[model samples]
Target chain A: MTGAPQDPADAEACPVAPTLWLRLEADGTYRVGLTTTAARRAGAIVHYRGPVAGRAYAAREPAASLESEKWVEHLALPLPGTVVEVNPLPTADPGLLNRDPEGAGWLCRVLAGPTDGRAAPPSVPTGAPE
Target chain B: MSLEPSDEARPGRLPSWRLLDLGRCAPARAQAFVEAVAVSVGEGRVPNTLVLAQPSAPYLSLGFHQSFHEELDPGFLERRRIPVLRRVEGGGTTYLDPDQWFFQLAYRDEGGGRGGPEDLKRFLRGPVAAARSLGLSAELRAPSDLVVGGRKVSGNAGGDWEGAHLVVGGFLLGADVRAMADALRLPHPALRPLLRGLVAREVTSWEEAVGVRPPWERFRQALASAIATEGRFEARTGAPTPAEEARFLEETLPRHSDPAWRELPPAPRRAGSLVRRLRIAGPHGLLVFRGSGEHLAAIVDGDRLVEAYRVGDGPTDALEELGEDGDGRAAVAELVASTPSFA
Candidate 1:
């Protein structure tokens, strides 16, 4: 169930929800962030409530809630894993999601589970990470 | 155009759509109907539709995530007998009545792949053009607001429901600014004049923006025509099916009327939570500061300070430098020290 590498130059993305990108780091953690398209669609994110560090969320379960002036959306990790770190930048200045969504606006980093690389499009479950 | 199948067919091989004009419905029914259409379109049971509705009675509509306790004055609402209902869409609280015309456009996701902002801009162009056709200069502002002469004439809210893209906005033909001010709980009692002034500066109605107020029916026809022409859809008049109406009665009505939905979830208590109120001397006049948690909001009389610069959310390095003791007076002093003196 590994996601096909869409871009050989960078991170692999879920075809269903191209807005979500997962990059596997050297330490076996997948750094996850919303693509610019997702960020723009969500509007200006004014608040972020988390996938707490050390907490493991199941696949399709909400990992974080992003609130904008006009909408609130729940974003889930494509693969279930223990959250290693959560970005503090968005909590301080939620505008970063719109200003620099792909870079500094990374939502959280999760320790890779056995099946962390699979594509879990927002529409369908790609099975929980082992 | 007649209701015949051939007449209903759209010209230019475009999709034909319905325009449901549910004129002057009860407050609860108005909310229910919009939700019904959104659900129907999302499920692909209904055609891409445009709905026009107006509440027969005055009521306060709360945005989906807004807390009723924090946003509205309950006593005022109770005394006035104005029912407060929470909408499924996200936006700030609004007071609605027959004087305003409400429009909602629901579309099946066509894979256009545009973001919310772009979608909103595209949806608004029709209304803006309709306003312009009436000889009023109107423009769409970012994040879904329609304005004339830089003052908002329409406020919009939108989101994806089920699988349908729903955008709802209202045009204020006439509004009671004073009643709107009294309905909301401002930070201080002394801020009423300030609120009125702010509203006067920011909001304009159709009658005020244009010289004459066209009849609501005329406005609706103009808007529908403009939208159909711009979006390339033939507008056919129709109503919700029996199943959709049943769904609204059984499901949407009860969910929106639930009392618990009006309140925000309780925030977790944190240790060392500082709540402070302090009065500081400002360049224009006395400024009152209310600081709590990581955010601070200030109130000041006069137009000297631009509205945007008056509020600060989350403490900055300057506030942290005041000391770890979290003294209210000390924080005020530190803030005043950094603020430039207005001579």
Candidate 2:
């Protein structure tokens, strides 16, 4: 699979936080998606979830959501940042990730950096890999 | 500001938060009340609050994540004066009436944690504190329920909004235990245990608690005190903003009351199974079946002809199909007929 395109123009687009397990690739790019730990705690995936383009998100805020059979849970941002790119397909069929989470399930991309310089996103605690 | 000063300098105790006693409104109104309260707080138009409303007639209420069939006899409820309504939160079934005083709290999600457990704890403390304000000792046992002296007084449930707005509420007024027991179709396993032991332990009301019918004023006083102390509310009254009201009505209300939305099971494979011969006969002839746990898939007509077969291995689709238009049997028949010939 081709690596996600890196665009300097995308970097300054809008801010979003990582709602699941995600990080910045060493080449100054972002890799954001849901964590396995979060999936189990939420029970089962039942409905649609995705993100909005051109919208800024704070760290730990939900840019998207996944519904279980009974309840729907939001995927919070892992790091404070901006959305530079988004895969529109997941919103139509969120279960894709819930079913085969490790691949083809990545939710969105964000330009990682604190907007307004309030505070950096909280680092995931040890053993917090859910 | 000075820590202490003359009478003018010292702020007097705030008056108790005003309570809107919705005395026996129609089922629709009871629902409207919930929507009004939720929309008001959810959109930040209203501060934290305690809303007490009593529907004039009986109604079956289901939690956000609850299945309608699990708790209510829809036909029976419809036949009777009761209305079957759904709420925008999670929890078990609650049977409501004039004798019961419904308590609701729409508040900001200020809990120090996140997810179900965090929200549950944050929401529960409000009512327990309310009960305490009313002069009753209350405690939150394991999970997300409130109890007084081993007997449950209130049950609470709600979801986190952006991990910010969380609405948690329950019934504190007296419940008609026998009627509720009868109206609700408790899952057999749960019922069997209740019939045997916990049933006796589950107590119902202020009457049971204080050995007399609780004075409405007293209950109100207690509820107000608790909410004022533990929750946040402005001393103003008005309808929720149009945007918030529209959202609740559009997004929240329909999701709750629609049977198709309410009873849709999460997964078809996990459904339970049972076969019962209704007294009424059907054109398809006598039915017999082999089903997956709870889903009816293949059935034999009177002559033992395989009349129905579901194409899928599990009941996920069946969950959505169950109560919709009340065509569970037809869907079952369709499922059976559609199955591959070998099975």
- Candidate that would win on TM-score: 1
lDDT of 1 by residue, B56-133 (tens): 988888765455776786667878888788765666678887788888887766422232545677778889988898
lDDT by residue (tens digit), candidate 2, A34-109: 6555555555454444555545666554455555422445455555566666664444455566664544766667
lDDT of 2 by residue, B58-143 (tens): 77666543445644654446667566665545545666677666665545443123444455665467667766665567787645
DockQ score for candidate 2: 0.07
Which stretches in model 1 have alpha-carbon errors above 4 Å? A2-18, A21-33, A40-43, A48-93, A96-130, B1-12, B111-115, B266-288, B291-304, B307-343
Give the Cα error of residue B269 in candidate 2, in Å. 4.3
| RMSD (CA, Å), each prediction | 9.1, 13.3
All models: lDDT? 0.63, 0.48
